[model samples]
Structures are given as structure tokens and as C-alpha cells.
Target: MYKNGLKRIIDFICSLCALIILSPVLIILIVFGTIFMGGNPFFTQPRPGKNEKIFNLVKFRTMDNRKNKNGELLPDEVRLNQYGRFLRNTSLDELPELINILKGDMAVIGPRPQLVRDMVFMTDEQRKRHTVRPGLSGLAQVNGRNVITWEDKLKWDLKYIENITFLGDVSLILQTIGKVFKRADINREGTASDIDFGVYLLGKGEVSREEYNRKQAEAKELLKRR
Candidate 1:
């Protein structure tokens, strides 16, 4: 009952309330983010949602667009300034995702949506993470977030999918709030972006380097055709 219907209802109500209640904070972040990041305050990117459907995921922009001499964007560490770090640590950067949840592109608790390009690299079991709506926070996030390996995160994601319940969702939500208050696992050592799941699979020999390169090439080709 909850999974098919009530869960979405609760998600809609909660997200709407959150947006209303957090409007001031959102406004402050938008103004500051625009001033510091020097672009739109919100970041929007295509992410794979339930059933591998793509949606534009939104979040507060927390990094500046710093380009190198050749005009390629600089690395995450170089672009993430002090103000950006504060937003990330406080998880204020995720505030805009409430809008996503309200729009039915995300849930309050479920597997986190992954980059659309990463979908081609996932194993059958890993692909199961998209069987449900993606989340703003999830079992994997509350468990270890960027601190855990991608395999471990996928395990948690699958576990959550298998055992999703109204009570379970509430529990995960509470745990997420606690973790955010403690500012736990905001980033992995030495970088703002965690280890890429595709790169990790290649490093562990789960996928050959040639396969990785081919998948990336295919994705790029598809993007050009689009």
C-alpha cells in the first residue's frame, strides 16, 4: 500500500512542507551561491530514476566554474571554495532536491539517483537500485555515504529496496537527520567528489579497462547524436 501509493503521498506532503519551511534558508543559499559560484544557484543534471528513467536532478550549486587554459573545467577540489565547502558540510547544498521530490522525480528515502552515463556500467544486481524512485537520502547514505566502497553502497541500496516499508522509511529519515546534524561523511579524503563507481569497478578488475573505455566512448557518442 505504502510503496505504490501512500509513500508518494507522504513524499509530496513532506517535500512541500519542507520547501515552505525552508524558504528563507533556500533564498539565502541561492543569493550566496550565485555570488560565490558565479552561475545559476541550482545545479541540474540528468540522473537515472526509477526504472532507469532519466530526470533532471536539482541541487544547490556548491562549486565555482573554474576552467583551465584549454577551457576544460578544473577538478572538483580546485573549484570547491570555502563557502562551497560549508554548504556541502552542512548539506545545505541538497536543499533544492525537495523540489525534485515534490515533482515526483525522487523520494524522501530510497536509493540515490546515479549519473545517467553510469547506468551502462552497472551489473544486473546493481541495476536493481533503480527499481524504486531515487532519494534525497537513503540507507546507503545513512550507512557510510562516501566512506564506504561502491559495492557496499549497492548492497545497502538493494537491501533497502527489498525491505522498503513506511516504518523503514521513517527510520532512515530520522537516521539521516542525525547524520546531517553531526555532519558525518560529508566527503572522502582529499576530494569533494567521491571515487567514481565505474573507476572503482575497473580498479578491482570487475571490469576490464577496455570495457570501461568502450562504455565511456559509447556514452559520448550517444550524447553527440542527441
Candidate 2:
């Protein structure tokens, strides 16, 4: 109980301090993004927070609105400009989420908020991640991040939920700092976007019948390797 209390206090104080130090940087990003992206500097999307509650999570816009020859929006690669890629590599794009923390919509550390569509694949056990407010950094993120499989990320989330403590949160924060400095696991090679849970599931045949048999075979092989 004391640890939980301390964690919240740490979240409050740390987030407040960060907001002060990052304010100038945030302002510059907004102006630059507006000029380059031709819209608001920030991107807002509904994400699943604690208890599966939805909240408008914010991030600095790291891609432009560019479409393909068919008039459909282009792939993430096509939309990702050079400046956007740099911002992502430096993790400056996530700065706007500090506002979410200040608004009581998130914490500085916990399971990173996931998309609503991703929630559909979560089992009851996996849903335990929602017991605490989603955060900007989490165990999975500090670990392998984009390199880890969804199943591994789920395990780390559960571990974090069970072992949450002030010290643990601090440790995760420190680890996140190292990751940012090293630009580790920021994106998959040959891709400008992080792997989407929905797309991964569809590709793996988890949501479709035609590919179900093939995916099931692959899953069995994966299990055997494990």
C-alpha cells in the first residue's frame, strides 16, 4: 500500500517536472509539425486505458497525410517524412503524452496504452493490464519493445502489474532513458511504423478462416520451439 502511494506521488512529481523542462521543445515541435504536416502538431487517437476505458491519447505528429495513386492513403512508409523519422528515433514524438499524464488520463509508468482494436484479442488474463492506468513506458517497452512478440509483451505486462512498486517504476524509467539514447527497438527494419497488433493478428490468421490452418501450423511450431 505504501509503495502504491509512493508510485503515484512519484508519477505526479516526475511528470510535472518533465512538463516544465520539455515545454520549450514541445512548442518548437508544434510549429515545425504544423508547417511540414499541414495540420495540428499533435495526433489524438482513442486508446484503451485502465479498465478498458477509452481516452484520447496524444502524440506529436510523426507522419504526413499522403495518399497513393488510387487516392487511398499511402502506406506508413510513404507518409513518413525524413524529419518525422528523426523525431520518432529520438522519441520526441511521444512528448505530448505528458499532457495525458497531467490530465489524470495516464501515469508516467505502467503498461503502454494499446489500441481499442487490440483489446478484442486480449484474453481475460491478459486484460489484467487494464487494472492500472496505461503509461508512457512499461516493462515490455524497457525490455525488447518492438522486437518482442505480442505474447511476450503480454507476459511482461502481467509481471509489471503484479510487481508494481516505486522502485520498479524508477527502474523502468531509467531503462527507458537508456533505450531512447541508444535509439533501441524504435522500429522494425525496413519499416517506419511499429508493428500493429491488428495487422499482426490478421497476418497470422488469428482473425480469418482462410489462413487459419496455416497459422495454426505455424503457432504449433512456435510452441514446439518454446
Instruction: Name the candidate that leads on lDDT.
Output: 1
Worst 10 residues of 1 by lDDT: 217-226
lDDT of 2 by residue, 45-157 (tens): 87778777778899988889888778888888888888898899999999989888878779998898986656656678998999998989999998888888888998999
- The backbone clash count of each candidate, in order, is 0, 0
Candidate topping TM-score: 1
Q: Residue 6 error for model 1, in Å?
A: 0.1
Provide the lDDT at 14 for model 1. Answer: 99
Question: Each model's C-alpha lDDT?
Answer: 0.88, 0.82
Model 2 stretches astray by more than 4 angstroms: 2-4, 209-226
Residue 54 in candidate 1, Cα distance off native in Å: 0.6
C-alpha lDDT (0 to 100) for residue 156 of candidate 2: 96
**TM-score result, candidate 1:** 0.95
Instruction: Tell me model 2's lDDT, rounded to 2 decimals.
Output: 0.82
Cα displacement (angstroms), candidate 1, residue 153, comes to 0.2
Error of 1 at 40 (Å): 1.3
Superposed by TM-score, candidate 1 places the C-alpha of residue 14 at a distance from the truth, in angstroms, of: 0.5
